[model samples]
Target: MLSNQIRKYTTGIILIVIVVLISVLLFFRKTQLNPVTGKKQHINLTHQQEIELGLECAPDMAARFGGLYSNTDIKNKVKVIGQKLVAVRQVSKSPYQFDFHILADSQMVNTFSFPGGQIFITRGLLKLLKTDDEIAIILSHEIGHVMGRHTTEKLSGFDILEKFKDSTHVITNYSPNQINSYITDLLKITFDSEEESEADELALKYMVEAGYNPKAFPEILEKLSGKSEIPGAEDFLNRHPVPENRIENLKSTIIKYHKRK
Candidate 1:
């Protein structure tokens, strides 16, 4: 009887090992070439699926920030700038439909993008920007997130997939209990320093191509970074942390951009 028990335990361990190996293989096998970077990345969702997911989730996201902004003129301005940025070569080539919206929340200085090009900026952040170029810098950065497929790439991570599997289900099918959690997960989906840096670079490239001065980026960074020093700006600081090195890198990128022009 003891020998039989040992044989069963060993077989179970082997099965577990095989299952883990297969999961890893399947995860690694789902790679697609990034159009902008020209590098292969592991992405489980197709471009169409990303578009569908973003479209499905956008209304829920907008609702969280008190729905769309009220001012007609400002709303049109944001959309015009976004469309111009999207018209640039680096971003226009992508198979994504871009739309820009201003959230009604006037107390939060935040901006975010959904996969396949649904971008949003809060009114608080919008008011802080001084000029059209500054606005372009912010919008272009969100566009960079779309161009980089940062959200989808983050979702494809093995550990993230495990944690969000239930939420992922909610993404496709509405579950009253799980809806809030799914939106929360989307809010928490932020990029690391490296990814942020790439987005910054892409933002600069788009800004330059869209006929906006790339120099506005440094000013924009300084303007946003200054918020962290204020006591009541915790919300802005959390969502948009601007470290000194990022500014330094932006400066270097600007030099390279000018050289290419």
Candidate 2:
């Protein structure tokens, strides 16, 4: 019995070492330079693959938000502004094709982006914006998320992949719906505080480059602060940095950019 116990312990150690070795191999093999951020990242998916995945998941995401908004004018407005930002910003020179949509949900006040460039804003959030610049700020921020490849980077992390591998029941038995749900859950995972700050900085730069007033960035954040009685404001706050903190960071960013100019 003692010999059997020792053997089991030895086998467990061997399995742990094997897992570590495989993770290390995957890490080195997948490391690639992110074009927009100029930082090396361990991403397992190509730009095309990211775009394809976004496309596959877009329908399901839209359905969750009550399908795409039926208003042509609102849809066109979002598309126009989104395209304008992408056209003028240097970071938008990536391989991902950017598309923007408005969700029909009038009660969920939030915005988000998919891996490759699909951005969506809810009608509920749209009604709160006071200016076109504020709209630009929102879209530019989502653009920053795409440009930074936050979703893919988060998904490709060693820990997440390991968890996914362990949880997956069969290698080839997963359905498209299951894959979509998995990716959707992954996307729902909030960006860390540092990432949120970085995306804000990116958005500020993009807005400035695109000739939008940098002040609008913080102004919108202030509007979205805790004082607001918006229906989904609490949910938004939970997923994002505190408004005061974001505003302070944006102020510093604006000062630095102005000094450079």
Top TM-score model? 1
Q: Write the per-residue lDDT of candidate 2 for residues 69-161, one digit (tens) a residue.
A: 998987888788788889874755678888999989888778888888888888888988877788998999988888888877877653423
lDDT of 2: 0.77
- The lDDT of model 1 is 0.79
* Residue 14 in model 2: lDDT: 100
lDDT of 1 by residue, 84-201 (tens): 9999986788889999999998888888888888898988889877789989999998898888888788776534234343232223554544446545776887678877887888
Clash-forming residue pairs, model 2: none
Q: Which lDDT value does model 1 have at 151?
A: 77
RMSD of each: 4.2, 5.2
- Model 2: lowest-lDDT 10 consecutive positions: 163-172
* C-alpha TM-score for every candidate: 0.82, 0.81
Q: What is candidate 1's CA lDDT for residue 238?
A: 67
